[model samples]
Target chain A: MKIINFILFPFLFSISTFAAPTWYPMPAEAYKFGQLYPKAQQLLFAFDYGHALVYERLLQNRGLITDPKEFEKKILDAVMKILKNPPTVKVDEDDIAPLYVYTFPLMVDTFDWSHMLHQFVLDVLATSKDRGPAMNRRVNELFIDYKKNKPLAITDVCKTMLFMDGQFFSKDFRRQYPSFNLLIWSYHWFQIKLYEALLKPTKAERDIAVDQVTNDFWTLISDLPDSADFDMMPETRKEAPNFYKAFPLISASFDNNHMLHDIVSDILASKKVPSSEMRKNGIDFARMAMDPEAFKSNNCGAE
Target chain B: MKFLALAVLLCSQMLFANQKAILVNASPNAQFYRDLILKVRQSGEFTLPIPGAQSSLTYSFDFDQPVFPETLMGDIHDSFNPIYFFRSFWDKILFKDGSYLLINGEKLPLTCLFVSGQDNRFSDKKLLSPLLPEFVLKVYLVANDFSCQGPVKPGWPATGGREENWDTYLYYEIKDPTIMLPMDAKLRYRWNEYSLVLVDRGSK
Candidate 1:
């Protein structure tokens, strides 16, 4: 019996030992980024957190915050602070604060989506060198479509616009005040604009162009800290700068439409008692603001 | 009693003395002309050009589904490239000479061909084809900077040591095509940073 057991044991062990081998071809040392060009990968990672923070704050305070506009303001202010000081490491599961647990899942999901979108942008830019204007225009169209189709009122538009309006107002006031809708729009616009700038000219030229745009973007944000409305205003082709001339109308329309979406989302998301019993007043407002014909005609010109 | 045992052993050995060769041609027509003949020669198990043998051996090939990482489907929207995201966890074997063996004039997928090398006489019969030997070659595509030695093993799982350092056993048999004679072959492969060594059984 012991002899039989020994023979069977060796056979069983031999059968179990035949495991497949694995290989890791790419190593960590191969991954490197030069200092001159911005680290788009790292920036995209940071942007992910900024978007999450706003979304979490919005969802957590959804019912508690009585005033939608006021909530938007606070969230936008938070976004501005994040842009000013982005986090270093990726947000881990444990890093989610107690107040943000409810919205954390949604934020995590959106981060995945945003990361894919960032990759898509990189792929598109990498492929087309000379079509900067067309690509930028296409990106703008995609953003508009995203807003109209799958709009996230609190995070996508409001916080984005606030981040873009960094240099316009005093840093303190900008940090204090939040305009959630405008922040989303402005951030997206700047991101797309950066892509456009990077796609054109010689490497040196592109670098200079991005620096100038970055400076201009910061300056514009700094000048108008309280409101993104001024930033969204239309300028004649002659008055506008070289790159801005190509899509002045579209840019202006996007800014205003985004703000309108923000206000509507705020109203819908807010806890204030509605004048009407029907829960769709905010939706109705969004539809009116998002109307393409009205947008072409500058219907929200007064605001 | 000893004479009886010896007679029984001699009879058994004589019964298995007749050997048969069956060819499985899986190579492309272009490569077949060049490689098939060479492989047979290098294998040293069989002789070619039997009087009654068919011109080409028949075989079929089938592919198995690739194994992917468990996290792939859920994380489709993540930034990482989906192709390299999953580790390669499986190996598939295909006939070097891309063809299937004909058993009684019917082609069968090349899964495992059972061959008896004890037969001393060669037969064209499809059932009498000898089994082909198999070799397991362990390989690691090491990164440039990393080394096979020291505290950090170059090609190892983060928490575990080198996978190639693990023990593996290979079983093979060599046979004389003219007369059935089984030559037992055992082998093992050990890989370090520079190259892989294919060692015979019992060699450290």
Candidate 2:
């Protein structure tokens, strides 16, 4: 019996390992970034925090942490502050730990890459003036080097670029939870637009614009419910089509990206709702969006 | 010996009886859509095989029921993939699976399935007259299997941008086949979309 058990255990383990699902990139258009800039990284992080805060609130509520609203408010405040005053260095160790636990392996070691990319962009842009022709030549060389070393596939690159265009959707994330996915996408767009405003050459104008936008974006997102109301799925989508329309390439890459965001939020917010319930809710929302007859019958805000 | 034989026959019958089915419904409200699925399952209109079946199931929905003209169905298909207009960041997650189930009879070649509620809203109901039969509850079993990793996480310099991962499966089902309408009429209706992919064993 012991011998049989040992053999079965290993075989079972192997089956489990193999059964684990794997994720892949969607298309080349998903990863294009015309110009990598410092503010872009900040914008991305701000969006991340926005998503994180939502999940954090949900998880805290689930954990019996009273006053999730307070924590949510604090996190939103922090996000606003960051938007106003972007972080200079990569995220602090403490912040990374929470994010790591929430996002897990995907977020692991990613900050370093983001920081490196930002620094590289800053260095190149700073030299563009002094180096003139040399700067231009060096920029081309850097692009080539980055492509070769950290080469994102055409689809990946296009997805990134498409983010800039603000119209294309990410196929992967969109497939799983369209509402939450759109919320995150909208957050990204808000950040991108804010970054563009802040990156303007005039420092004074940038600062003022950043503060205004940050305040407005926070107010907009804060108005959203802590948990997704499954009944209101279509109404939410109709009201926020631009948010959905904005990030197609990135959305296509993974279903779990959006799922995890909600999962972690549920955990952090201490929402008692089971993961299965959340998943089912997401699936139903997806079906409603796919059915043409249903779409026509339902009013998504527009008459 | 006779009792033993009867027991074996009964066990075999039970084994063969095991079945699995997935039903998906969509609404403008995410919470409502979720509840609708639960309601449908509880209502027992469909029987799901226990011990789970070897095969997988999927369901999909579209929330934005963009109304297109019946006259332009051919033009829309000839010029571009109309799906692109409705495509958004949220749509990516649904396509993680290679294919999806079609609720209507409409035969969709692409992996994704489109649904909308807007069809019932049109004043001129005749627009959907041509394809009404094909548009009701239909199912499509995909011939190919495609697998991929989740998207790379968007970076956040403040917390070190994190990457995320997920596994997805796509399948389709046709719910109503009697409703036939022109391609343009079909595209004109708006509906909320949703989908379900069979998670591999132990995925939960």
Candidate 3:
């Protein structure tokens, strides 16, 4: 037994020594405002569920509803249930959206990376007493750090609808399923609008703004695809002007992120792109979105 | 005996390298960071178990690399390659698997669970300016005690910085000539108050 113990020790030790992949936690001070801003935090978590659930359903064709209206109603109903009682912890998106994750791993990575930045930015605003120089510097530094992951980071440069809608595969998802498309836009809308709310000078005022924004989001989705609240996708510049003005780089990044979401959905939904080529087209679309040199189009602002 | 020796040899060849740690000290602009570092420096002497037995350990890190915090945030890839962002500084400590610290003639054991790094240079060149001028790196020593029960509860103190993981924060900003990075550190031994400390060599 002693001989066996001695023989196995070094091998066991070496086996344990091999490097296992581990992730860095958000900055030491991150998520400080979780308790302070439950409503916003919970909503963000729900939005995550909504994204994962929709992509999985769309990409996998789980229910196989042929009619567009039926698909819209079923998806919207399920998503609303999730939003009503959102998961406490972040949904492990891979588990929910396996096909989408498998099809476009890099695209999913880009979204997750940018979404983390979004959460961190909100925390920065929520934890700080006021939107002062310190807050501005922190936000700027976060943005600077956010672009470090070259393959995954979305370029903050404003992309034209030409890149998003002009492609042959573009607009298929929205055309086929307007309600789900609009639901995603509403998610983007509430995200930026919440930023605008958090930017209010005082806590008392900020609280009120949050409630108002939440109420407005509920109102916007009261009716399904036919809801008259907003026919067009909400742009950051239009929806959260204050947040956009205060942090232009972040605002542009949000717009770019939303555009990428639309682009990916369109690619997946379009039958023009063969199944074998969906992965390739997705990569090209993502690369175009990440390219900083792509010139902007004035006509591309969320209509 | 021969078989045991061959197994040992194979293990040594395949396993980790014993790399010496070099710490750099960079000052922080954030007030929360400043406070966390200050508290650790003032705490004086404490001991922790390394690989084998209890030993005194002192930590000194220099984070003076020009890398911004946001850049570190970007480096976090949720999938396979997650450790690149913390490798620069944390790897140094990792290389020294079991170490000791003596602060003011008291023995303390220094233990670390994780380190991560982020570098912007690994990104696309087209996005960078001709005079990129600045190359920045940030590394973290997240000494989280996993023993803390339940998930991280949301309602933490609003005004101060909260460690994402469990308690007992120990930060050190070492100006050690041997380890040459510029980083300011903070260590908090939380019964729940936020503070940071700096170690000037083993002299405390």
Give the number of the best model, judged by lDDT: 3
Ranking by lDDT: 3, 1, 2
lDDT of candidate 3 over B111-181, digit per residue (tens)? 33232332223223222221121122222333333232212334545534553544544442332111222
Q: Provide per-model DockQ scores.
A: 0.01, 0.01, 0.01
> Which 10-residue window in model 3 chain A sums to the lowest lDDT?
A14-23
Cα lDDT computed for each candidate against the true fold: 0.34, 0.30, 0.57
State in Å the error of residue A216, model 3: 0.8
Candidate 1 overall lDDT versus native: 0.34
lDDT of 1 by residue, B44-116 (tens): 1111223575332222333222122111111111122111111111121223233333423544333311111
lDDT (10s digit) by residue, model 2, range A1-303: 232233223322221111111112211211112122345444544454445444433432334434434544455455455555543222222121232232333232222223233334334433243434564455445434433423121111111112211222223223323444445645534533442343344546655655665565556455444332333112212332432233222222121122323333333332343543544433333332222333232222233
Say which prediction, candidate 1 or candidate 2, comes out ahead on lDDT.
Answer: 1
Off by over 4 Å in 2: A1-89, A93-99, A110-127, A130-187, A194-303, B1-204
Q: What TM-score goes with each of the models? A: 0.33, 0.27, 0.54
Q: What TM-score quantifies how close candidate 2 is to the native fold? A: 0.27
Each prediction's number of clashing residue pairs: 52, 204, 53
Q: Is the docking of candidate 2 incorrect, acceptable, medium or high quality?
A: incorrect
Residue A102, candidate 1: how far off, in angstroms? 11
Misplaced by over 4 Å in model 3 are A1-25, A62-65, A298-303, B1-204
